[model samples]
Target chain A: MSVELVDVAGLDLEAEADRVSARIDDFFTSLLQPPGDSRDQLYAAMRHAAIGGGKRLRPLLTLAAARLFGIDEDQALRIAAAIEAIHVYSLIHDDLPSMDDDDLRRGKPTVHKAFSEATAVLAGDSLHALAFEILAHEATHRDPHVRSELVLELSRASGPNGMAGGQMMDLAAEGQPLDLDAVTRLQQLKTGALIEYAVEAPCIVTRLARDARTPYRGYARNIGLAFQITDDLIDFAGDEAAAGKRTGKDAGKGKATFVSLVGPDRARQQARVLVEQAIDHLSDHGEEADMLRAIARFAIERDR
Target chain B: MSVELVDVAGLDLEAEADRVSARIDDFFTSLLQPPGDSRDQLYAAMRHAAIGGGKRLRPLLTLAAARLFGIDEDQALRIAAAIEAIHVYSLIHDDLPSMDDDDLRRGKPTVHKAFSEATAVLAGDSLHALAFEILAHEATHRDPHVRSELVLELSRASGPNGMAGGQMMDLAAEGQPLDLDAVTRLQQLKTGALIEYAVEAPCIVTRLARDARTPYRGYARNIGLAFQITDDLIDFAGDEAAAGKRTGKDAGKGKATFVSLVGPDRARQQARVLVEQAIDHLSDHGEEADMLRAIARFAIERDR
Candidate 1:
């Protein structure tokens, strides 16, 4: 519940990339303090998934977006924490035996592997609840409209029409023949929705009208695809240690992906093009958007 | 989503229990119209779990409470649907192979039996997200503060410190020597929290302060315990055909429940006492509280 009152104006995104994980970890560490007794293990699983590792890309995107608009640091960070919580929840659920069946994530045992499957499911469910809890808090924004809107947008982005919908498509399409458009739509929901929310959330906080949000949303959509392409590329051809998960999963499951459909070389080229397009969408902004631009590049550049 | 506006005030609780299912079914039917293609199965599973049966006790509680305050019928039903969505979601997840492993719910095939386990999980998660989405909607209430608080309360009720936490304790307590107090605490979270929210949501919509909610909270707590005790009694002695879900799972699992701790006669007597206490807490109100009083009695008297 403690908010670190950092000077968002003074923080440099490029410089803070290394520190972002620690900051987010600290945020989650304080945010997820167990209420003790029999439920302590639930909190422990949540902490293991939430506080320990990962690049914190989604939250960093939220912070970078908030910085672009000079939004209140506390508001931005709480929103960031909410976004990151959703991302982490999705990862935990995705790693479930009924889903991706992964044994590892962030180079450690997945939630289901480390905890009982029932505990992992409950942990993920609890974190999903916590995301809304954060967004609905008065501290997230003084304006009730902003808080409500944050809850609305976050829920929509993560719900059936968004991330959950995308995951459903992904599950249904497994081992089945799928075209490029199908995969694109699937990824757009599973990964794209949350990423778009990460960027657009600050806009919601600022109450920027939807008509005026084209550039920001375009940037989000493009980077989202770019990020997914890079992910597929890594899975298709990257070191297991570097990626910190079971790579070649798409191929192992005989599912078509960006890499499989377009081929690795063309997929990489598409990702580069998408990242460039993402940057282009932000051309209307000045140096304030530099962090967002760097993140777009990082979408393709990150080995994991 | 289409909102079916019922004149909650004119509706009689004792007479309406039979009608509540059809009304809630219509609401969920319209609410969960799945966009076509691969994701349709997810929605189908959601509809399968949400639409068909069950007593609709929780949402009925919300509607009854809303009647007390003359809140908008649409707003009331929307909130009711949100509460019901959370309830149905919990049931779906609870029946998963990893959890209670039940094959039947509402006298029909469980979600996982009707669909793949992955789809069931996603469907449950989607319903969970949909609950917040409904609460955060502008139509739920004109006041954003009301909406935000509802989100906060419901999330808190359903989150780690509430329903999920309770479920965790329930899982851990299986085959363990759980005392009466521990069983009470576990049930308080697993089932009581959401029920408490059901009675309090209208208070939130009306912006009733916490200090003013003592009687209401007391009423909720008592009825919640009464309802659970009745449920345990049913599980201990009632027919599975009448209960919808499998009976005797509590003793079958060797977990201590209200009936396990207290003799069935004492459990029944205690439930009746709690119901009286619940009705007594609402003594400050007049005829408007009659429905709630009816519900309290029904809590102890219903066979199911």
Candidate 2:
């Protein structure tokens, strides 16, 4: 039984996703290589890694969260772009031979596999630095303190204690018997932290009214965890063609995924519970929360 | 003949280097993982790549410049540490299989060779991000505009048109004939950019009186270029043991170098001229410029 948001029209969802995607595309285009630069190869590698595929879920969450707080979309776009940059950088490095060693990501050859490993590594490093640079540049992000906070949040989420740390845990536990709790903790840091940062950065930047910030944090945390759970579920049941990735690879690797620990049926239930908790926090905002609610449910139920 | 600055006593140079080194050690220590964190492996890789060996040349120049302008050493320490972090990150990524493919650095196994490639990549990426994060957090850099400038300068130095671009050029030009102009441009982007940033940042951060900032920029550019040329000379003449790297590797790789484009004797002559030009920029300043003068000469004249 897949859950879907009944009130929001399907066309609106597509439009919102497209809108977020366009904004992100434009952001990368603008900040990524100015004219007359001789470093075309490096810029090409960066663009190759950033553009072409993957749902702009993190940036969309950032925009939606800001919209719920009544912040202007223009004001939120840089922060959104910064989140996606960091996310893309992680994916690039994660695909390297020394890491997950995956040949394909989002239906394309992974960065290191497609380009040379040196370019891929440098591309990831440059993109990671670019995220903060884009955020810190006054022309892009005007408020110094807000820019500072954005850098801090992105760094914390991307660094060892966050996504990188989660990756290390995932690497160490590849063939180990991790319990459900260990799996959850790993996912929370690996995937959840960045998602949480995406949802909360705009609020932190805008200095949302204190009362509004508190509940939104709760809303973000739940959805972030829910997103990871659904991601794992998809990996478990997803078709290789539709998913654009090799399915069931996790089990072959002896990875301790949520489904591996608790079984798929229970994992699905936990995901739904998380979606419910995520939506509950936005009850006070009514229609303003509708898109977000739809997104949370959609994230779990989508085939790819 | 090797140029020397008689004004800067050896004791003073050692004292400043020691102070900067200690501060860097403290910064790395504070960044150590909390017990039970999943990032212990990644953190260890980063520490291993960063701690001990190598001349802290970039950071020393930063400290020396700040000192010349009467900025307190305490105020410059964070920025100095930040520069070293950037330099270390570049080295780790450069030595990876996809880039330089070197097996060793500073007489020890390269980070990727010592640890897993994934850890090396992540550690490099983390250190790059950490440099910006540390700079953004500088309490001393309270002016938003100045802080923004610092971020931009460092980013430009670290990004495509800077170190990354240089590495790409090196890759593209390997075993190919590169003219003197192309080689100089590449070195400027690769090595000179960071050295330039190292010198300019402290002055920018301190909001040095306009007159001082102008001369500092000129001095930095000359010293930066001179430093790279000197590096080529050392690679041509220095011993493997003294350089902490295999001597004559560049010649073996058929890589273009200043010494390759110009004869070794001519390269040495050019380096001396640049160093003299670098020192001349500080003529208006008194004894404070002595250390920088000594450093410029040392960069070119050192055996290693």
Candidate 3:
């Protein structure tokens, strides 16, 4: 009863995202149950932060990439869940009082606001640990070598030299005069690393060699930058009610963003160009990659 | 040339600790260098928390356990450094304002105190990611299976079901009275899980089978409790200067500790008895386990 690739033509990515989001919610529901009564509250906090909100874009990227290889759905879902865990954990920590100091996330109280700051911190830490645990588990992959590679790549992407490093740059950049190159590097590290992982992880799971991955890698990189550019555009001009969060935050903080460095017209033009280039990398694939192409278009077109 | 077992008899465990501590320092110095200049400050914050002033007991435990399997010293040092990273990362987060709120750690300013609260969070989070990064690298172990197992064990020990769960319990227990059973469970999940991993990681590196690991498991469980009991005892009556942190904190907070529940004399006696029992678990290894036995004694006798 496998799903047919032909049916995916003219794919509505927003609907596909909602479908994967439902799967992701079920996945988190199963995994977040506290082991014992003592930890019920901690698990609850994790569930609250992770289960209900966000675009689930990273996981969707994983699923879309996995479709290119005909990877097992169950296995791909597990990897997607792991990637989402890392994404949510970063959000939980980023929203803390000491970090971005946000009281609201996705239209509700942030983890630290709903729970205590200490619980929020532990929940974030635990979710980070859970990401690695899922990747290393035997259930994630049959080959130990594949699992090790996944673990290595994800850890490197998230560690001091990767996502965390990018985050440090972001925090330090607030109200500082960062050049366009510096801001690009910061965005690449902050959000681009995980996006790269999402696109590349399925390759690892499918045992694709380095030379064979150039197209996928190129596609991921271009789309990642495009995604960020659109994010900046949304922050600059989108409605708060439509975006589900504060708007014009980059301008408010006087932070350098794509929309700030370039005029809105130029930024939008660049995002459209990048999205077209990203889609060009998928020309080798047919209907199997239709969702990826649709998502590339959606990257620039979406309001949120 | 390798040191002989006969030379390690009547070992100056403190000197051995210092030797391993130096190795751990060198390891962090190499890994914490930022790949690009952008993340130098985050790397700096991680170095500030990890490199200086602590007992380094967990790493010592790893090195000691590796000795029993005749593992390569270089390999053992890498694993030990990874364990130390996790320990230090935990301490960094534990001392944050949202947690224990300690300004001083090891007689120096806590990471949050020395750096900004934001840096402290990133440093700790980055360190946690770094631990798994070290373990998954090919240099940690040649066998991918061994590396995967090491990653799985470490992640499980640190995740929601283990260290984080215990942390949740600790926060919830701050103002409430917990029974001895509750406290014991908390300590087991908090510190005991990692201690067990420290003892057992070498077995994975050596490919030691399940049945052969019973004694090591027994030894680690007993000594882990003994170590926590001794910590409570130190907090009860040790000198602030010698311990390198504030003393009498548990009592001041009116929190229940081993000393508070069992009385000073009985808690001391209990720790000694547990340490002796822990040593007995290593009897089968004869001279090969001398360091393990010595460490059991040291767990109770150390002031900090």
Q: What's the lDDT for candidate 3?
A: 0.87
Q: What stretches of model 1 exceed 4 Å from their correct place?
A: A1-14, A239-247, B1-11, B239-247
**Residue B212 lDDT, candidate 2, scale 0-100:** 65
| Chain A vs native chain A, TM-score per candidate | 0.91, 0.91, 0.93
- Cα lDDT tens digits, model 3, B1-304, are 1355424543668688889889999899988886667577788888888896798888888889998989998998888888888889999999999899999998989999888899999999999998988999999999999999999999999988788888888887876868888888899899999998899999989999979988887889899999999988777776444556554777566678888888889998988898878888888786667778778878886766
* DockQ of all predictions against the true structure, Cα-based: 0.80, 0.54, 0.82
Per-residue accuracy of model 3 over A23-92 as CA lDDT, tens digit each: 9999999999877666888898899998989999999999999999999988999999998999899999
Residue A98, model 1, lDDT: 91
Best by TM-score: 3
- Cα misplacement distance, residue B239 of candidate 1 (Å): 8.5
lDDT of 1 by residue, A1-304 (tens): 0122122322455466757777778889998888778898999999999986877888888888887899987778888888889899989989999999999998999988998899998999999999999989888888999999999999999999999999999888877959999999999999999999999999999999988878888999999999889888887776344556565667777788998898889999999999889989888888778788778877887787
Ranking by DockQ: 3, 1, 2
Error of 2 at A147 (Å): 1.4
lDDT of 2 by residue, A202-300 (tens): 788777765767777777778777777777787887644454655586877888777777887888898889888888888888677777877877867
- What C-alpha lDDT does candidate 2 achieve relative to the native structure? 0.78
| Candidate 1 clashing pairs, residues 3+ apart or interchain | none
* TM-score winner, 1 or 2: 1
iRMSD (Å) of candidate 1? 0.5
Give the runs in model 2 whose Cα sits over 4 Å from its true position. Answer: A1-9, A33-38, A209-212, A239-247, B1-8, B138-145, B209-212, B238-247
